[model samples]
Target: MTNTTKTILGLIIAILVVWGIYSILQKSSEPMANEPIKIGFIGPLTGDMATYGETEKNTIEIALEEINQSGELKRKLEVIYEDGKCSGKDAVTAAQKLINIDKVHIILGGLCSTETLGVAPLVESNKVILFSSLSSNPSISQAGDYIFRNSPSDSEFGRADAEFIVSQGIKRVAIITENTDYSQGVREIMKNIFQEKNIDIVADEIFNSGTKDFRTYLTKIKSVNPEAIYINPGGSAAVAGLIPKQIGELGIKNVKIFGNFLLGDKEALSVGGQAMEGIIFSDSKDLTQLSGSLIEKYKSKFEKDPAHDALVAARYDSVYIIKDAIKSCGNDDSDCIKNYLYDMPEYSGMIGSYKFDLNGDLLSEEFVIHKKIVDGVPQVIE
Candidate 1:
């Protein structure tokens, strides 16, 4: 009697185990009705450029809310954020995790050019879409078909900066470049333009990335006694800011200071303080009526203004841009998303109306000169 009972119980247990395995398989095979489409974000959440990352993060959150609320997609969107810390090595690690572990077909970051360039190869090889909201290194244009950026390239930025310098009759200039993809790209293009226009580059100095003390570079720049000094740094607005402040601390007078787009950043303005007064730099001409409205919206929603309105707006647009592509081609098709972006018509958004070229670079953008510390606030000088 005991053997018979034990055998019957064992058979029952086996059947229950098999049924449980079948049920698990069935559940795994069927997609959840409300499953989210996961994407990846690689940016510097804790670095000198952390402000930029933080701003983009907040902007994306706003975009997601708007998109999700509108009910434009079959599934909700979710992001897995990885801090690249504005470092290439860190970005590569983040990219690997996003591509392999998270299995995300789309990524929305690497805000710094260093981070974008770092992850470019991995994304390209793996066929993941890497859409950078703010990285502007010209090299990114050729990174891969799957790579794109909403920000204008430094190629355009360099040309605008160079032309502005020439127009101002600034014949003699000193150029300081922080050795990183973004800064180096701008330096190269600007130098070439300066050479073509017969402008004198009296002192060309290069510094390693993340070098906090720019006093040595400033001293050399002072010694050159150029009519102007162009401060280009790849990492933080702080680097761009500290350079001018140091120039002032060195008593370098009568020199017009110039910088890239970042020179107008709030962090730069705060760090440079009075030293940034009358300093001219290039910025997106797209920062007009539309951007003003977005700024107000951001202020109202977040209870604070974005650090860089144009950049934050572009980050916000990137989310929508990806959203449209995902809607058109579905979330899993990286190739379709790439094609959709490449052939995307001129998209008008908070930043501006623009299209992508074959290389995924913005087809058009305009630059305008800005002066800082005009009555204690930045002013559009041109």
Candidate 2:
């Protein structure tokens, strides 16, 4: 071979090698849509708070369907659902399974406050991201850098409720809080605000999750006959049913009753029946901001009304936010998604436009929507 020919051959080989490596790197950087992106979900799918979890999953599924069908990303998404049972110990077990066994870099939930709090330390240590759907405990603000919740904070929800109650010109109210992070945190905030407004909390009652009977506390409140009764169900959907039933059976009346966000569920009507009627509550939702198409899609897919629960919006928005992060980051560096969300601009979604605060909680444009039960269902009121 001629010397010139040999030089040209070497140049061609070098170019081929460089081109091959470049192609591989590019392919790796942008994962194929066929590849599975595994995300974990830990929530109370089988315990007392199961229905809330079930509802959350419905929204998640709808979000996933829309996302996957859009051809938005190359990688397919898969969710591994684990039953957190709304207990910290159970949540810890579920978290271990998701992180160690399933090898998920991002988790969608630990829906209730207990599960989220339980998994926060582990996920933060393992460099995993946990984004909660409905955990409103204020303590979670200090849980970890990796812990973020889409739902409004307990302080925000509580203050909104307190302000609304005082605005009604009712000076005396009774309060009953369930023993849980969500209920306690919100209860404390409401108490402080009530104190600030000079409104008397005539009777205060605290109950545990499994406490079937609340007659003693209800009897006390009945005697006081406060202008209104404010009850925090503590993330217990079951309590929504039982409490109203007992309140009715006990013949406790002559005052308006109020509830937290959890009372907006249909369980209150199906289980509480006529007893659930006329109860008032405040929640972090401005329904006019929600997409009518999304609501219709949920009804069509699930064969039921979306109930407009804040958790549904929170979880639905969580999916889209993660999808956006993944698309922007383009690699499963986990840290990339964390940084993206840590500095994310206003994300316009089902829950309204949201930006992340330093604590990883969504700085959502959420307001307390005061509701009243008129005809076996909760209706938004002026």
Candidate 3:
């Protein structure tokens, strides 16, 4: 062969070899038949709500591990957790990063309502499906079709609380809540319900979100001699520690105390102890029953019981819900998964039977009333 022709042929062969190698690498890098699915988790990992966020993360991790090991979903699932710090700006930033950088198709959390609201617009604009485990603000679901929550809205619990108190034949009630949106929202609903039922609201008090001294408010509330005191402050761990002591010091043991789901934590139990005994609250599900063997397993694995009770169940169910939706779609196409989720029927989850409504809110009427004891242990009353 001529030298020029030889050179050209050799170059062509090299080009062909390079192209073949590139094609092989591309094919190998593509998603495997049994590749793991990646889901983004955003919540307050390091802030006032960090305990709740960490609890949620732990639950999600355990659920993912179980699902992956069981092969129930038929695909190994992985979750990438981002700390939103329970701030709107942080949440929005985290959502954007999850969408643009990680490219996670489905995102879970922003555990607080304010954070969820801030992140909703970003998730909707990007067409990413966002699920919250504990945000109860009704407006979070109202934002767009992309937003969905496993937790019951505050309104549902608020109404149930009102009913429970009224059922107890308590004619006079006082309202106290934190200044946050979730606390305010629940307080409003309870107040409206009290008005509708013609129950006397002896006193209404609002406290700053991080207020440590609640003696003034509690004392003022005590003066009314209400049959019951409704404290809507969801994250009242700080206040709970002091309120019980002050309530006892004021010689007001007769005034029954009622709390929202926020008072269900171990912190309340640790702080209030016997003083918290007999305090009533409403919950979406009975954690003691719902937790079942999962709690024991979690404690063994993590050296501590799961933080938020049925919240871990909610996180667990979110994975299965996504898996079901993915199976229905039969592909990784975002639009297909989105459509499948919309059409999903009532699924029996660890928390409850979940079926999304027109506004992407889960339609499940499964709440129970409970009371706390010295150990902060919750017992279902009805």
- Report every candidate's CA lDDT: 0.85, 0.83, 0.79
Per-residue lDDT of model 3, residues 324-369, tens digit only: 7877777556677777777888888777676888777778766555
| TM-score, cand. 3 | 0.86
What would the C-alpha RMSD of candidate 1 be, to one decimal place? 4.9
Q: What TM-scores do the predictions have? A: 0.88, 0.85, 0.86
Give the TM-score (vs. native) of candidate 2.
Answer: 0.85
Query: Per-residue lDDT of 214-309 in model 1, one digit per residue for the tens?
Result: 788888888878998988877678887889888988899999888887788778888888888888778876465666776787789889877777
Worst 10 residues of 2 by lDDT: 284-293
Positional deviation of residue 121's Cα in model 2 after best superposition, in angstroms: 0.4
Q: Choose 1 or 3, whichever is better by lDDT.
A: 1
lDDT of 1 at 211: 85
Candidate 2 segments whose C-alpha is farther than 4 A from its true place: 1-34, 248-251, 288-290, 305-309
The TM-score obtained by model 1 is 0.88
Model 2 lDDT tens row, 22-98: 99767656655577898999888896777777887888888888888997988877788999998999999999999
Measured on C-alpha atoms, candidate 2 has an lDDT of 0.83
